[model samples]
Target: MNKHCCNDMTYHANFKCDIHKDLFECPDKLIFFHERDNDYGLIIHDGGSSSIEILFCPWCGKKL
Candidate 1:
C-alpha cells in the first residue's frame, strides 16, 4: 500500500474488493489513486468509468 497524506486518504485509496470486477463496479469507491500516473481522482459513478483528477487530498488538504 502507498502512503497518503492522511488516514482518510489511505483508507479510501486502499479500499478494494476482489468481488468487484473494477473500480467502477464498486459503488462505495469514491476516491481513486492511479499508481502509474501518481495522481488522485474523484470517481464519477456515471456508468462511464470516468474520474476527475484531484490535486489535493480532500481530507487532509495536502497536495496529492
Candidate 2:
C-alpha cells in the first residue's frame, strides 16, 4: 500500500467477489485526510469520477 498527500488525499480500493465482478475493481470510495492536521473528509459513493460504490476500504475498511 502507498500513501500520497496533496491539496487533499483520497482513499482508493478495489473488489472482486461472487458479486459485482463487472465493476472497475478499484476504489469505490475515498476517505481524504490531511496528515498536516489529521483532519478527515468523507466522500460518499455517488457513481462519478470521484464516486464510490463498494463497501470495501483498501485504506481502512470501515462500514463505508
Candidate 3:
C-alpha cells in the first residue's frame, strides 16, 4: 500500500495537515457540511458505508 507523510503523520493517502487530511472509519455515518458567506450550506450524506468523494478542501473549508 502507498502512504504519504505530513506533519509527522502517516496516512494511506495525501496527508497535507490535520485540518486538511484525515481518515474516518465511519465516513458514511457522518454528515459533512460546507457553508459560504451568502450561499446556503452544502450538506453531504452517504446512504450507507459507501465510498464518497468531496471536491472541497475540508482543511481550509474552501472549494477545490
Which candidate gets the maximum lDDT versus the true structure? Answer: 1
Q: Considering lDDT, where higher is better, how would the candidates rank from best to worst?
A: 1, 2, 3
Question: Per-residue CA lDDT of candidate 1, range 4-55, in tens?
Answer: 8899999899888678878877898989888888888999988878999999
- TM-score ranking, best first: 1, 2, 3
Model 3 local distance difference test score: 0.31
Q: Write the per-residue lDDT of candidate 3 for residues 1-64, one digit (tens) a residue.
A: 5121132212223223344233233332232322232121223333332334555444345543
Leading candidate by TM-score: 1
Model 2 Cα displacement at 59 (Å)?
Answer: 12
Tens digit of lDDT per residue, candidate 2, span 1-64? Answer: 5444322234222123355443323244355433565444444445543433334344555433
Number of clashes recorded per candidate? 0, 4, 0
Q: How accurate locally is residue 11 in candidate 2, as Cα lDDT from 0 to 100?
A: 24
Checking candidate 1 for backbone clashes, the offending pairs are none
The candidate, 1 or 2, that scores higher on TM-score is 1
